[model samples]
Target: MTEGVEQLYFHRARGLTVTGSAATAIAARDGRVLAAAAEVGAGRLVVVGGGELSALPFLGRADNARFLLNTLSWLLTGQYAPAGSELAKAVTHERCFTVRSFHPEEDLAKVEGSHVVDARPYRSLLERIGGGILPDPYQEQAAFLLEAELRFDEMPRVIREAVTTFRHRSNDYEGLLVRGLPVDAELPGTPADPARRLDKSTWLSELWLAGFASALGFPLAYHQEKHGLLFQNVAPTPHNAANLSSESSAILLDFHTETAFHPHMPDFLMLHCLRSDHDGIAKTIMASVRMALPHVSLADRCELFLPQFRTGVDYSFGSANGVQGNGPTLPVLYGNPYDPYMTFDLDLMVGETPHAQQALEALRSAVNKVQRWVRLEPGDLLIVNNRRAVHARSEFSARFDGRDRWLQRVCLVSDPVPSAADRRGSGRVVETVFAV
Candidate 1:
């Protein structure tokens, strides 16, 4: 074991001349000094030749594990030994390996009151303004939705309850689904491909989306994705089916916290279905941490709290994405252990330690054990609390026969006024300004 460690990590660093060598190499390989000691003013520096020796993968090597502790002890204590003397491993307690136990604060509660709404007055109001309400510039359309909300002077009891349930207890409910929205009679067929240009006229149910988002909070947009469009089209496009994009990707589309890597991700994401797939199996699935936490063992919970995982930025964030290091190391769960904030991605987050890998697997197992399922149809709007739940879509075949499934998607934040202050000009899209 000692010979292997010496050969692997301490090779090729022997010959550098040191006038003030406080420590010297005793187990070097290949005619070089692997370990050496030097001084800088009042401080001491222990230099290891092969930087890769410190990586996580090499930490399990017997001497490799002891090298760190011994080096730190000698440097901090200012201890010195003769040129040919080697530093051996020190004594340590055993409790470091056992995890402290803890319990999650909340249980995974299924979101209810999500599929109820009254369609009469809403449809009547739109019918009164003809079958269309296309306004120039997106801001005007948003403004019109705000003003038109007055049409429902007395919101239907059920719709009022549904909207109210979403605002005050959204974090608890996870999301709300409103059904029976007014769909246009003469609807355009499914888009054949991704938009070649930005076009708001193609919005399936603009007035409803804007009004719904306004009632909850103002809608938000990102400069990095969908060309900064405040509201984007979600449909099965041949171009994106193989990718992970929520807009048009139809392959299984794994569950993920929307923009888990973004510092200023939306607080809510709204999706209203304009058409369903020819087959009815493309159900939208959501998993809430509230429900999954109860199943996590205490040891896994402790491991999950350590910042040993890195999540990669989603592709939609655009070029230079790869250059950016995987986002800062952070725990899968943060904040109150009972009701913590969760940010994860099966495709992106990588664990750096054994405990982290164990925690990731435990969390994934818990999430996979339970889920909320919804099948979208015309006039159905799904409002997901972007903070508490991870969402995904079931795979469905897209024939591209102009009958593909179509939905309108939008990103929304609770308080747009503050975000607006940071936003440049009057544009709806907020670019990189704040850094977390």
Candidate 2:
């Protein structure tokens, strides 16, 4: 093993030198010397060379590869090691159902008694808008007038109540299926059938605007043209159908934090399940690094803080997305002293330092420790704290039976951010997924 290591090191060194690049190489007798050859940038490129690479045993080679990569990463990014900082001492979990449900009767009473327009009606109004029906023109105008007179403060109160109730228990994900929001009783705006059109103005007036804004405050941010809501449909395309039928098994998607490439990433992501897997096999997996932190070693934590890592894009979005490549290594955790943030992607991140490799392994182990699997059903909504957790999905078959899995995903950036201005300036709502 020793002989092979020596030979391999020499071979890599020679490769670097032969390419006329200045690099660090260890001689058999002289030990280690840093040599400078400039091609791409200023620095001694370290090269480990040898045909003995093939002879190196699996474990040894793995270590060597990790070490070399981490080193290179550090050289390129000029960042420090990971600190494995602890973020929240304890996260609060609240279930949505436990919160005060939006009640129209109660709200109506308040408005009648106090001369205020009840916002609860707005929830029903949104349902009508989303249902794609035209409401009575006069009723719609009146509903809008009522909504305009209603106090905006009440809207936030309702949203806060809902959010406070739905924060997850122990885990980082939270969920709530908001029901009873009035849907438009009316059918399509233009219809051959008149019966489809019903009185939907009230539903649209109260529910739609409130729901959209509420989503912005708690889990969804209204980041115009930058990042906000995402709409996806399970169309009957051959590719989608093929994905449904062939990938039904629990296929492991490498763990990743969403949109690491983007400058502004979502703090939370909500996926509303409109349909479930036909075979009931697909499960979404989430791993909290905070939960995994205790398992990491102190030394590994230091390495992780080092700026020797690079993140490639994830695969959901194709390659032509114009994302930054081979950027500097960012620490896995950072933020307030008490509440640290996280950035990680096992598949897209490359560590180029020995310490960074150690940190990566430690983080990997920690993530595995707290991994949670959730299988979603129709109407089941999952809200993930994107900054605090990494998530992936287990592949499931989609039988092409029109009953294939379907989900509605929306990304949100929470409080203390510039949301209203961003949304007003840009019409872009959906967050872009990076390609790996």
Candidate 3:
């Protein structure tokens, strides 16, 4: 093992270095390609010489796997951004590995289904670590959790396979639910303060969900709210009834991406329910633009794919943090236009032209016609593919009697954060892109 190899292990690996001028991993040793890539005709190609580049990218030595995955991911997608590591320079080409390319479709999406895990095996596993999945220092906890064999080894095989499928095949639905995690039947009271808190015991269940999400993508955080807390408590607050924040009043939260206006939004979002609302009527709604697009006219779809709209920062960003200039005029849909990624905020985003406005409305109607709803219960985790679909919360009456709905939410980013350079410590929150 090299001095800075992080903890990646490869079995009987052979050394394969680029004999020609193609760029290579930084300081490869013991047959490891820390980095390397090149353009092959119209397709991109990457050769990782070191560690295991096979199967799961986030399981073994997730730290180094990120470097390996980012190298291949950028080449495949042609969306390259520096990882802020002085150790290696950026590669110039892209290629796709096992990670499946997304295929945009014109059909209405199917409702997402749940993959349940048995609680008995998980309970026995918890006894080994005193029932807590992560160690102290919350900001640094995710890395430790990722290293646990209990999480990686014991995750239900069916659930594991489904996650792999989503990672490879472009999904045509909103999100999937994972049920039967260990949660206390006797629940904690819903918190009311700005510092909404949960007990460590409760965190154990959510930690399992986080590990599941980490298997799909890198755990990511924002710098602005709660000083960029990795696990944010999504609950009702009296002051935020219409604020357009995740923690805003639980009055019908609109269907939108977790962070649409920001340049570095998370690729996936996992919301773990800590407590269910009293009436259970507070359903989480998701709308697949893919499913709705078939109903939309071609003209409206064309306008949406064009840069005819601009969006404002969600209130959670506050008024002071980032991108305060006139919001950039951006297309609602971009990327592989056939299987496009979308950015929309019904309240904060506005279409510049009447045609754009009509397109937005048409899109809303199309999505609404095929919306799917799920009311998450305790021990349930919902993973939304933020790239391919939009999610919103329905208006729920908040009794505020310590039993209102409570969910712990976290975001995942695939690429190494471009703002990693500005992170002061904790290595989680990136303050580089905004005016901090």
Candidate 4:
């Protein structure tokens, strides 16, 4: 009975025993009557053999969603419902299922004019915060983070407001760039050793990273990654230059949501640059589902919402993190349908079915068409909404002489209650043993 619907999915469906002449078999699977319809007075009744069609998860698969909507419209109006019409899209369960409209181009344009903050006026305040010798950021993180939070009000108003707005408003742009921030005049060369990079006297850029990240949410560290350091280093290492990680320079790092396979993923990821690549061409690219959704077809969008894909754990998290194989099957897109959030890892995510595979390719092409690039400088900081965006790095030449591009990275989450069990004794670091 669904208009313009050529296919419908059925799981363990039974035959509808049609006895009356008024009953009509509109859909059938093999020789079984999967669906039937009957007209009564000014209304109609539709019987579906598959009871699971009412469930949201089942409705999103194949053409079942459209069939349900069109059937509902026909029953209410006693006429053939035209496909892609407003009448065919109405549902009686709107109260339980809700969605808001989102225009990515318009929302992105509104934030583009105010993404960068003039940091020259805040140099004195930044110097005061990072000038003193403080507790080690990694070893004594509690004390160090408290020190940064205490000075949150002293930060620039533009940045403070921007961070607050970006945190609360989910439809805003995916990335924020802060330029002219203060950094250490004489910095050590980019060290390959993760621990050796943390042995620094001055803060400056690190302070900026902490202040902004703390203002947005709680800064997090993974026990299995980077020795659980609050501020992890992102620089090319000779051993990992050909690998698929932030330390790789020989290969293009594919786009991914930070820690997509983890249960308690970060809400925000901040990258503060301390140095630039030798050629200054290694660009960081980011793409949002909001920007790419407009380019995708309705059929592909429906397929993407189904739980037909799996994401693998990053090698950086190590293989002993309790997660095995491809972790769990999950949908690439979730949350509000119009303004949704997505988790995608180009190198680690795979579609489980043929339809999902085609949809995944559609998403990949859309993201590639709308991707934006940013070349970070020595005094620049890029804060990304990790849930709404996926980020990647371009391939660049790296010299082993310790002058390669260096960036300090940190993650934040709006709410920590969901991950409370994973954290050890109220610490910022999440224990890898309990991560699944």
Candidate 5:
């Protein structure tokens, strides 16, 4: 295992060098020498093999897998074995929801018979638009009209009815399945088919956007400005294919609040499963600060409120120069005093004071306490209140088969925040990674 780890490390290091960074060897007290790696100005060193990797040898296929993982974790997390290293201090979080068979017959029938819009006309309009028949102005107008129709004064009541039964009380999250939309929904015909599969005009697509924004108290304008609906067919694309079969065993998606690095992060992030990996093992993991706060020490929680922390811009979108700076570090817990908002990313967040470090550790522990696991199946939608939760995905084997997992993602920004002009430059789509 160690030998395999060493080879993989060297291979990744070579790739990093090509991208303008290099990895060097650091001599340590024991025979184990650390590998010092840096890209641009960011630097990290890996301890090679330790606790988490100890079990790798018994698995037998690789010698260096553990070492490589430890090194990568150090780079991505800025700490080795963050959760595993401090088990006692690890906060206990929970997955308060479960996947039950969503009875399409019962659920769909209920929605169709409810006050929800029939959605047939909307689907027809979308199919026309997606087939490249609708012009840009017409498409935009259609979206506006659809939104207006769905926004009757009593619309909220209907939305409440749609999801009331599925609301999970243990956590501040809920979901519902509204299937049976016209299957031929597609995008408008434009000379430039940016999202080739279909334009954002499909009836089900618009319904999702409308329903999600309504649930979060965000207006359609806010949804269009601060968030975007993205659809990706991961089947044949080289990048996506690689993402499925990538050798990280686990893709180390460091824990992060969706868009926390931005001044206007989405209040909610919704992912609806359209397909599932054949083995059904791709688990989305989430840890809530709300659930973990009780486990933190009083002193640490207080210290964590200081404004001495900073998060890196590694995952943010901005100009080359703008991307170099760090995000403002206020307390991870702030606002309503009793029920504070949380901002965290273990890899990017940095504490400048000893108190901050202690507080961060305590917060980290609290976060680990309520670890929740969600496995998405077709027609399942996971709605995370980004302001209240941090999420990650457990790595799953992606064999590049047609059955690889696929999801449609949508984000929503709630009320009170100003519109796009108040937050971003013109001609951009809500702080997307490429918008800046």
Candidate 6:
């Protein structure tokens, strides 16, 4: 059972009987057993009084999802039982955790399924936000963001529903691509460098990104990256063409979880493409841990949960200027064992031991085996759950001209209170010092 989870909203609950000697009353309501767990002959059993506990509406009310996930982990491995109990003591003392890592080969076929939202019908409604005039995205003004949040409900039901689904079901897919979103009628030329700021005449694309991010979570920024600009420009630049950053085009951008080493890393990283590459082949590659885990060996999966890996900060965050220190040693995978979260970067993360290195390589191989490529076109917005997937880009030719591939990036966090100490007066920017 999850601690501090005293209130749970359920549609209808029934009474449960704990008849076995090994049974434990994990939960109760008005002295009536609402949930129970028992150790059978060679297996474990968990029973809930309500079938709607896993339903979406019920999950939104309290820590139902966490409770269910904890219950699942307990039943699968016999760990995370009621603290201070005999089962909990034995589980903790032994540390004999088991992972159900075996999965059918056909599961890969189902994991590649796409969740696309056709935004063609919502163009008119999107254009009305900000009184049809969008303010400068870099300006530290809260009015536009508040307006975007208020107007998010006015969007088409399909768009709103997609956002809600993406928010709730964090393990369903790695990314979501919304197509046919409104863009500027007369778009400005693509900036030639990351530092070059374009004078945008219209804010259709910006508004769409902000509105969608606001609806999902609080849009965030980093003082160390892009000077705390809420909206960052992702385009090929001559200086960064040969580097390992987002501005590079000549070199393949290695797979990475956005800000993987930082404590307050964004939960969702969104990219809205205003212009595509000249050849239209610069694919955005993504591989989810959910799909890749089944391909990994059980031993390697267990090793991935060990604290034998360290990650370095990205160069874009001033890593070259003595800020290139590696983060604290951490496990590559954590959370629910069956469906876990990951933090990985092919270039920045390194292993501390020989077996750990092998485990990391195994993870790389599994991710490559199930990687998917997406070619983003104009009016396409891609939202990725940073914790569940690692993303990269295929190498492409970049002229560094005004028409090169251009995309606007935004970061989001599910909740902002965790970074309250890093932010200034309800601002969206999180300080880098605190993040380190």
Candidate 5 per-residue lDDT over residues 345-414, each given as its tens digit: 7656777887677777767765665555567665455666677678766666655544456555556666
lDDT of each: 0.64, 0.45, 0.63, 0.76, 0.46, 0.76
Q: Could you tell me every candidate's TM-score relative to the true structure?
A: 0.66, 0.50, 0.67, 0.77, 0.53, 0.73
Q: Any idea what lDDT model 2 has?
A: 0.45
How much is 205 displaced in model 4, in angstroms? 2.4
Compose the digit string of candidate 2's lDDT tens values, residues 241-268. Answer: 3221112233456567776655566776
Worst 10 residues of 1 by lDDT: 89-98
* Over 4 Å off, model 2: 1-162, 165-229, 234-250, 320-328, 415-424, 429-436
Residue 331 CA displacement from its true place in model 3, Å:
1.2
lDDT for model 5, on a 0 to 1 scale? 0.46
Model 4 lDDT per residue over 1-436, tens place: 5677787877678889987899899889889898999986667889889877655445545566677767877887765566543432333212123233333342232344555566667788766656767666666767877887777677767778877877787433488877768888779889777544456667776677888888888888888778787788889988888877778899999888998888888999999999999999888888877777766655567778888888878768764322333666789889876577888887777888887888888888878867777788888888899989999899999997879999999998989888889988888889855333
How many clashes in candidate 3? 16
lDDT by residue (tens digit), candidate 6, 50-165 = 87766532443345645766687777877653442333323322232333432333222233334577777766665664346555665635777766676777888888888788
Residue 98 of model 4, lDDT score: 22
| Winner by TM-score between candidate 5 and candidate 1 | 1
Per the 3 Å backbone cut-off, how many clashing residue pairs does candidate 6 have?
0
Off by over 4 Å in 6: 1-114, 128-131, 321-325, 434-436
- The 10-residue segment of model 6 with minimum total lDDT is 89-98
Distance from true position, residue 357, model 4, in Å? 1.1
